[model samples]
Target: MASWVILVGRISDVDHSATPHKIITNRDYLAHPALFRGQRPNVINLSNNYGYQSRGYYASLLASSRGHRVIPTVETMIDLSERKLYENALPELEQALNRCRKELGGEIPSRLTVFFGIAPSKASDRFARLLFDWFRAPALEVAIRDEKGWASIRKIGFLPLARMSEAEKERFVACLGTYTSREWRDSRTRTQARYSFATLVDPNEELPPSAISSLRHWARVAEKMGVEVEPITKKDLARLANYDALFIRETTAISNHTYRFARRAQQEGMPVIDDPLSMIRCTNKVYLNELMTLNKVPVPPTVMIAGPADLEIAAQTLGFPLVLKIPDSSFSRGVKKASSPAELKALATQWLADSDLLIAQKFLPTEYDWRIGVLGGEPLFSVHYLMAKKHWQIVNHERGGKPVEGGFKSFTLAGTPQHVIDVAVRAARCIGDGLYGVDLKETAEGVYVIEVNDNPNLDHGCEDAGEKDVVWQRLTQWFIDRLERQGR
Candidate 1:
């Protein structure tokens, strides 16, 4: 039979003491060998100065009565003690346990469990430190039961539950228990044989209905491949440390919360699907242009114009029928097409009125573009994006009107030419590994890179001209296989 130890402390204490006197005073159970005449099991209750009123104290007393020994411990004084009291006290507790075994005239019980009574405080405060360090032990399990009397066990690994309110913490803990103990235990035997994995999705972006349909399709694909997909938002990101990877559908900027979440996950050595570096490289069109040009990848002739004086030189280099784009803008909101020098000047002046950084490039006359979905350095699917009827942009251009219906043509295999594949591969290599959509325009000369989007739209029913399931399956399997290899 195993021996058990319980420590009770107050939620609020005026003394501000830090010590294992709670465990130390419970020494009498093991000290008195006669108390355990048979293998009925040994139990020690270490509760004192808990500030529990009559009802709470009496309930604890009744629970302790089931144990063989009940001992009380208290701290008389503590004021500005600088030393790490808990770290120092742990060794003392170990020594005292050894002494108790010696007095018992035999080896101590093989199994020992300790339960703590936690109190709220600053995360760096002494009490928090004590709970964190102690609960980190492999043999220990920490739990908190709220005022509603619902108890839950804490999951292993670092989580932000310390910042949660008592009620929230209790609910989270309870959910953890239910998921791991019940839902997991009831899973298929095959799934149980493989490594466990979890993923999170952020819903910050106001995605088009088509995009939402695409996500659901992919979710189903992932489920079929045995990878669990959990949708989350910014509010849920704070509590999502247990997941192996995160897939964010939101557009990420350097100063945004999405970027912060990615940065933190990277610091923790957890692989993020669309990593922060990938976002930084793909989101900024200017940066993408520089990298693509340096690698000799095909890109539209482009020049940067910081002010009105540079616009003429840019127009001279790129010529008329060009596109002017503002830096750090997406969804084709800050873009305009100019057919002549006069129109170019007017557009640049209006655009530069709001911001300085502008890019001018010759506009390709292609009526449609290709959105190539690349995952883990390999191209998954290619979808042709046709412009809306009478609209130059693929997205709707009419004001206060419904989104324009556009045509799509998907290919399971790389239907793009070999030269285009080679160029896209080189460009994707420069962008590094992550999920991305590269917009390319195929010209008589070669495929020219238009823009790289960090959070590209995925439409399901919009394009099914080819083996769409094959592409979805490949992507799903890749995610599952990667997580399995990482031992998630």
Candidate 2:
């Protein structure tokens, strides 16, 4: 649970009777220390002016320095004040504006006010959400214009509460109540959990890293450990500042919203599982292959293919029956087996259209691939992912569009082979000391590393079968240890 406070330049700017939150003036907030000395509450700075050295600016600036999560951060205030500073965000905002324009029959109002990511009209609510994601503020005014047939963002700036009309003030109060309610999960009414944990999950994800049941199980377990666990989605990006730590349960990719969440959490100074750096390192196969080889981790002989011109060279290096993979591929979707020279040429040519670089590794025929779940640079659980029925890969995607995955056999850490555990930990360390599942192949020769995945599957019955409570306990402790180290 997180404490919250609303700061305004003038006490009369807002009707305190309309809201339950404590509203303080900028004078008291800046001069008084007893109000929020040690308690770092989520501060909502709705000051009237944000000019250089203004009280509004100082309120937010001081709140940040006091280790409090304040919206309309100094950086955001500065960025919104200058066009060049916020130009990088215009492309995405313009794209969102065009989408909203289409939703309104290719026409929309030239001006709109967004209060806590909620538009006055329901038609533009999505655009409001995107705007809030980019610029976190209490109120924002977006000016849209027609350029030919498309919509463009002409100017965007902060909207203070004092400028709102009576009806708009009522609506703004409702919006403020809605926004603060999401962040203010008081411990008195809730459980006695000392820390709030957010598990990022998507129920609509086709193949999520952790099942909803698994997330529920972890939440129940975490509650017993004095940690209030909440399942949040991608839409809860702005609310991330309220949680003490974040655990991503969705499959992570550098180009997706998962990376954005991770990066945002890192920026908020929160401990996040599968941090942005780990996602960047593990999402791309070419990078992983090079990193493993450079770290002296045992991996199959692999070659990189730039285009059709380099296909022959890759073939000569790895030979036939090689594994072909796009740079950013997961779940065996972009992975294929090139059994012959002609098939290699066809697959390489087709895959080259999507990515400039491809990875070709010697295909090691193994009955099962060993998956060692490593956390905090230590091996936690091990499983043998068997090959699909008469299929070369663990997941068979060629049979229609649906995927058929093979069975998994879980093993206690002590029951697993030491060599396998050693290789998995070493490979995972090459990436970072975060949660990971390292896939390896064992043969008569030796164990070879395949891939190090960032968000490993911790399904209810699959990964937790061997070490049920121990798994949850250690994971909870991981966050606790890091948070305590940071004096959270």
Candidate 3:
């Protein structure tokens, strides 16, 4: 069997068009000229654009120089025009690869990898489908880097025959059998399966149907790709050692079960999707603000308030018409805007009564915010979120009433501003590597970090209705690829 290693580009590193050339040169030096005596090694380059200017061509040139074979997996254009029909092409991609392996004397290359080169110009429905197909193979190694420079070795699926000892294989197979049995039973019931997956939130907590819908969509996608996804509750977290991976559905804090699961999963050597360290670092507004500032990333002025008095002082200093938020909430929950001293005082008082900490910052009256999804540290997709009508928050519920409709409008990835991309990457680096959503605001001054969500919702019908399916598809593929690497 042939041995393989996968490398993904750091999305943040390639803001200029010339960055791809830099990456190609680095790969060539590391794997060919320096390590392999100018001999080419098998490489797979994954990217959205298929144009001649794309990274595929860059990979081909590098491979040819090293006298090695390079496989260019050009991802199809993801846009409103092609979003809904992407999944239909998965089987074709898989079949093509299987055929290639068969023709290569039945010896599949030991390393299959993916790179999230850059954010797409548009969100594609088929993008997710393509990712799921790529990850379905148990023999793939996955690495991801986001638009920011943060990079991580996300997962290694099945061990290559050349790398695994007989004892290691036996132990892995035993663990697999246990996980498979649980998956089999969980798949039979929605409730049971959901509770069996992983604990991001308390299973007993009454999640909004919107949240449940998102979870179901992810579970369905995982099933379609031959992975069993079930919800694991806080009470059952100790059993994490039995699984190959853990999937989290929302942002969480250091005190939450989701973080606990991540810590445990990492210790056990299981690939924890979304990752615990990522959650702890991203969920805290204060931490994100400080990190961004330290890294010279543009961020709005922010103050952390520990009590009502502290909030009042901060409010007076920051001025009215500011944004106030809890340290660990997503989907615009526990976030509010204060327009006057009286309003700020009252809101601060109430918030302090309910939470231990709050963040007060100058509100950038930008009409829209950007939600950039960084998977395995790579910016997979981005969408512009317009504030809800008659509401200041993007996904806020009414005052003691149900959520209002038409509060958000999503634009294609191409529509996002360059500043949004710059600020997003800067913010993501502060949060470390994993899967995350970098929320940003473009003010007159510049782009600022509004919040960094560790578990940004991947709801099927949320902000970007057109790209919801694709988001899940890419996410599923990420998990699948990670698992393959871990097993390897």
lDDT of each: 0.52, 0.82, 0.52
RMSD for all candidates, in order, please.
Answer: 21.7, 17.4, 19.9
Model 1 misplaced stretches (Cα beyond 4 Å): 1-210, 353-355, 398-405, 462-465
Per-residue lDDT of 207 in model 2: 84
Best-fitting candidate, scored by lDDT? 2
Model 3 over residues 87-142: C-alpha lDDT tens digits? 33334444443444334454433333322211111222132224433332212233
* TM-score-based ranking: 2, 1, 3
Model 3 misplacement above 4 A: 1-210, 223-226, 305-317, 342-358, 403-406, 463-470
TM-score of 3: 0.52
Quality of model 1 by C-alpha lDDT: 0.52
Highest-TM-score candidate = 2
Better lDDT candidate (2, 3): 2
Compose the digit string of candidate 1's lDDT tens values, residues 1-488: 23433322333311114322223222233123344344333222323322211222222232222233322211100100112212323443344344444334444433222212122222212332343233321112223222232222222222232334566445433433332232111111111123223343444345332255566777787777766666666666555566655666665654455665665455344556567657656665655676677567889999866568877888788887888887555666677788888988888888776553567888887888877777777776677888877877776645555556467777655476666556666678777777677888988877998887766665675543455677667656665666566565
Ten-residue region with minimum lDDT total, candidate 2 = 185-194
The predicted structure with the larger lDDT, 1 or 2, is 2
